[model samples]
Target: MPAAALKPKPSNEPLPTQSTAKRPVPLDTPYAPVAKRPLPPGRPREWYVTHNRRLKAMRLAIALLDSGVHQPDQARDETIRSAARLIGVHPPSETTCHMVRALMRYAR
Candidate 1:
């Protein structure tokens, strides 16, 4: 008998093809955190106590300055006093106020 007549026919099933493209993956290295925890819902604690007082004091001082109640050039001590009063802190001296103003300018 011949070799062709002794073998069965192969089936017409499809063969699986593999992809050659590289897939992207996220880096697994650890990184330092940059975000802070979000504040809780509702009014913040600082708002009622610190922030409110500070804003009121600043507004009072600015109003006084703008209304010509005190001269800006000579009222550094007064401004600091008014701010301290609004915030319920001890009134700072003229020198302290000058330092505060200079520090504030530098901070910005």
Candidate 2:
């Protein structure tokens, strides 16, 4: 709502009603350009690897879900890799593929 359309409430007036409450506004655009931000410093090497693996697994799992692959058993490495490709992520490692299946199993 435009600020100019609002009227000042008198001191004796009751609190604003639900009709005046804020509504969720839709975004003007859905696509966001990726930002290039550096990772936080001082993390252990193992931590970085695990963090990256988790992110890859999450993206792959969501893609599989969107493509109607729900069960962990149905998400074999080849299937997971194909999902990765469909989503434009690099082909994941065996460990990352295992993580993807683990994510699917945990979803329920």
Candidate 3:
């Protein structure tokens, strides 16, 4: 390795200064997180699949809206998937993307 490579780069971060008193965060009523309650036992397989897909579509729609995509026309598959990753959910399937668009269409 060249001698130049041995030198450490300076950090862009400023040296820590004594923090001032933090202002109280404004209270905004945000959406509540999913309830911890488990799904009831013994549902049919297809019921669960449709149920989960509905949930995923709803989440993706909300994420897209939050990211300023207000119209169904603006919600392409890739756009919905990007929103999925942003909200920390699994990427939605093609069908779920369709459902998200449907939800957005209905909401307008």
Count of clashes in candidate 2: 0
In the range 6-82, model 1's lDDT, one tens digit per residue, is 89987554345634234343333322333555545588786555544544345445434433445445557666676
Residue-level lDDT tens digits of model 3 in 1-108: 999999999875555683433534322334456776677789998998999899889988877786789999999999999887776788888999999999999999
- Alpha-carbon shift of residue 69 in model 3 (angstroms): 0.3
TM-score of 1: 0.30
| RMSD to native, candidate 3 | 13.5
Clashing pairs in 2: none
lDDT tens digits, residue span 1-108, model 2: 988679775574445664533554333333233465788999999998998899879988977886789999999999999877776778999999999999999996
Model 2 lDDT, full chain set? 0.81
Tell me, by TM-score, which candidate is best. Answer: 3
Candidate 3 lDDT score relative to the true structure: 0.83
TM-score of each: 0.30, 0.67, 0.67
Candidate 2 stretches with Cα past 4 Å from truth are 1-36
Steric clashes per prediction: 0, 0, 0
Worst 10 residues of 2 by lDDT: 24-33
Task: Let me know the TM-score candidate 3 reaches against the reference structure.
Answer: 0.67
RMSD of 1: 23.9
lDDT: worst 10-residue window of model 1: 25-34
Return the lDDT, model 1, position 51. 45
